[model samples]
Target: MNLRQTINSVQAHEKELALFNIDADERIDEELRSFFRTQNVRITTAQTASGCPEEIAVLAAGETVLAVVEVETLRELVDGAGAQSRRLGVTDTAYSEVLSHLKETTFTSCETADMLYASREIEDRARRNGTGTVHAGFQRCSTIVSQQAIYEDLSRTGVSVHAYGVPDVTPPELAGGQVHAVGGEIADLWFVVYDGGSEESQKSALLAEEDSAGRFYGFWTYDSAIVDSVCQYLTETYLGGNGQFPQFRA
Candidate 1:
């Protein structure tokens, strides 16, 4: 079916979705065909469907596309009865004359091909690494403490310390198979990221902060004694290193 016809037929399905891509030029706004025509208005406008604002007047603009999306949700009417499904429209609005504009509505052109390639590269690497305990450095805390001591005694003397999570399960691309530090912070997987409310769920807060790495960056605080204890233990352990070959017993 033609795209326009398909767009008209979209309705949320309980177990599936209907999607269609429309060229940017086919949109309500001036499309590719009117690129040259758009220049006369650019002096007073900041919108660019082609992502090529004033560059040669989109001399060779690529085809931009937006996805028409629809979603379905189900709710249980009773304890054992089958749930009822509700159809949701993507472009629908409470006012019959209005339309919705979501980030999903943004047009993506050939510019995204590089991003797509990078994602595929990351996927290919995970497949090669397989599922196994990747001991990045096999540092048994004792080793890290020693390194910390050496760094302190020679490089830094009185600065408070922050520990780095080593052997990060999945480090950034530039890490080169060697993860020296853990990420900024770890989430409490056992606890709800937030206290749930009538308007929102705890998971909603977490999901809202979820980043490209699939991690939720939650804020937290800690007791000073707990911090001191950790510092003292590491300092003592490192300072009391056994008199062994190639060791710093200072």
Candidate 2:
């Protein structure tokens, strides 16, 4: 199969092999459902930050791994190439919109950074609570340029990183443009298309799917064993039982 096909296949079957969640409680209404039915793609919400409860457990595990890394390096990795904690997107227009939204929104300026920090805290806490091995994979633009930077960053924090792609996935034109802006690098990047339809089609189809299913959601669940293995590697390779990292509480 071609790249696009490969991406689609990967996305369609992501949950078949991985452990993830679909929030069945957050359903859409009928009006939205009817509107979405004519669309070609579906849009569903997934927890991407520390605030979501479903993600809290796994995020905590990620934090435990991060605590062992050097703080200055972690900060540098986050403040990549002098870019601040601003909204990022695949195109100029979208980027602009993200910036505008960030400025106008009430979110904290250090939201992303804090989220990263908290992931470590959460992970540490979870481990203490005896939560069995947790596996978490982060998804972002996975190309060569970003990959090296991301790899270096995650490596310092003791995360075992890998590159994966969704099959048959033609990243949105805007996303493609963004990747280009960063230099056609796909190294540390992993791609997961949230909505598998045209921009116009996605909004409606997503609404319809949510309404029919009585919930709004997204896909892909990774293997818990994979998460455990990666974490174990990091703990053994870098953490080495130093216990210098701060302990986390639920």
Candidate 3:
């Protein structure tokens, strides 16, 4: 199969697998359902059989329910990101809080966690918890998140990283042209589109710090069209990749 087809197949399998694997409770908590609904997260009730491995909730951003959120009830919440704390799978982020709030939801254990996985790649506590063997495929969290530096955050669930550290690679003075936020929202706006060679675009030799999502940050745009155009340039030119796209002498 082609790259696009393979990606789609993997995505489809993941969605089906997530739903099929969940062991839902008899009834969902009304308050918990209401809270998620308010945040635009679609929640549904599941019918789990008696011998199911673990319980989980289908969480969807759009029509696709690509994730499962296991509910957890807590008498007290403990939180930390240190080595010891992370190994225990302890987290108090927004994702975990929603799970904690639900009274009827049963938490998803590591053994049962497949779809909506915590970003922690290491399984230091696996020998004790007996969840599963430490999978080699986990992404080791990065320490420095500076521009061009990459890291996986426990708070986020997808390949996309929305969190970005301050920009140190690119200076503001080199910005080709500024894009300010519109609708009366105005401030210093800038962007750097990777042109395959460097973060600096040939059009505007200015360097915008490349963020975790592979986009240049540290700028705002008043005109949506300008930002869209810049991003489109990045996608069409860079996203295709160097190998897939054959280079030619101009």
Best by TM-score: 3
Off-target runs (Cα >4 Å) in candidate 3 are 1-28, 60-66, 73-250
Taken over the whole model, the C-alpha lDDT of each candidate is 0.22, 0.26, 0.26
Model 3, 130-235: lDDT tens per residue? 2211111111112122211222221122222121112322212212111111211011112222111121211111112223453322221112233235444433
- Give all TM-scores, in the order shown: 0.15, 0.20, 0.22
| Lowest-sum lDDT 10-residue window in model 1 | 70-79
**C-alpha lDDT of residue 227 in model 1:** 23
Residue lDDT tens for model 1, 168-246: 2432222222223422212211111111112121111100123456442221112223223322333334323331112
**Candidate 1 clashes between residue pairs 3 or more apart in a chain or in different chains:** 25-31, 165-182
Clashes of 2: 34
